[model samples]
Target: MYDGAIIMESLRVGTSLEAFPLILRRLSRYAVKTASADQPPVWTEFVFEVADEHAVELADALAEVLDQPGWYADFHNDEENFVIYPGRVFRYRRGDQLARAEAQEHGRTLGVPEPQLDWTD
Candidate 1:
């Protein structure tokens, strides 16, 4: 079985809250939550489990939202990670970060290395 998650980060600036319901409606299949407890209630995080087949759909929905001004979102699975920002979505594999600036310019996901688990050593 494959597992994945989608995490969206939106600033608390102007009318950003207005996009919440639209996003929830679009991604109704996934579980949703706010980051109020962990954050200062200024940010919200929606999380949900997804199968391998649903990854594309999740990315598309996130891409739509990210296309709008002032919104940022991301999706990650065992295979890859995506960063969605205004007007574009960046795609890259976990632990990869070649051409980050170029990716950002082309509206593509940058390659960022996954955080190493120091405890594993």
Candidate 2:
């Protein structure tokens, strides 16, 4: 199984939420959380775990939908991490700091606040 979290508030208009309900169906567990951050104040997310098979679909959908400019979402399996930015997706080995830094730099350039770029592996 792969664990992932998608910020509900970061979704952009014109993108399909068709994947949302489908993702929930396979989830082993889930909960909603309002992120504790200062930039945008509170960003709510749906934290969940779905079968590994959903990773590709989830990444693609998130890339298409997440509002760019400091907004992103991520999920990971034991061996890999998938970070999705608007129209972009980055997959790197877990604990790979170099690869993680590249994704972070991209996020920074997109105007994502520094603190918001932190995603635990």
Top lDDT prediction, candidate number: 2
Model 1 stretches with alpha carbons more than 4 Å out: 1-41, 67-70, 99-121
lDDT of 2 by residue, 4-108 (tens): 777666787566667443444232223324333423455555677767777788788788888855688888889999988989999999999999999999987
Across residues 1-121, which tens digit of lDDT does each residue of candidate 1 receive?
1233333444332323232222232332333233223223333345445556655665565555542333445556666766555446566775665634444444323222122001010
Give TM per candidate: 0.47, 0.79
Cα lDDT of all candidates, in order? 0.42, 0.75
Per-structure clash totals for the candidates: 5, 1
> Residue 20's C-alpha lDDT in candidate 2?
45
Q: Which stretches of candidate 2 lie over 4 Å from their true place?
A: 19-39
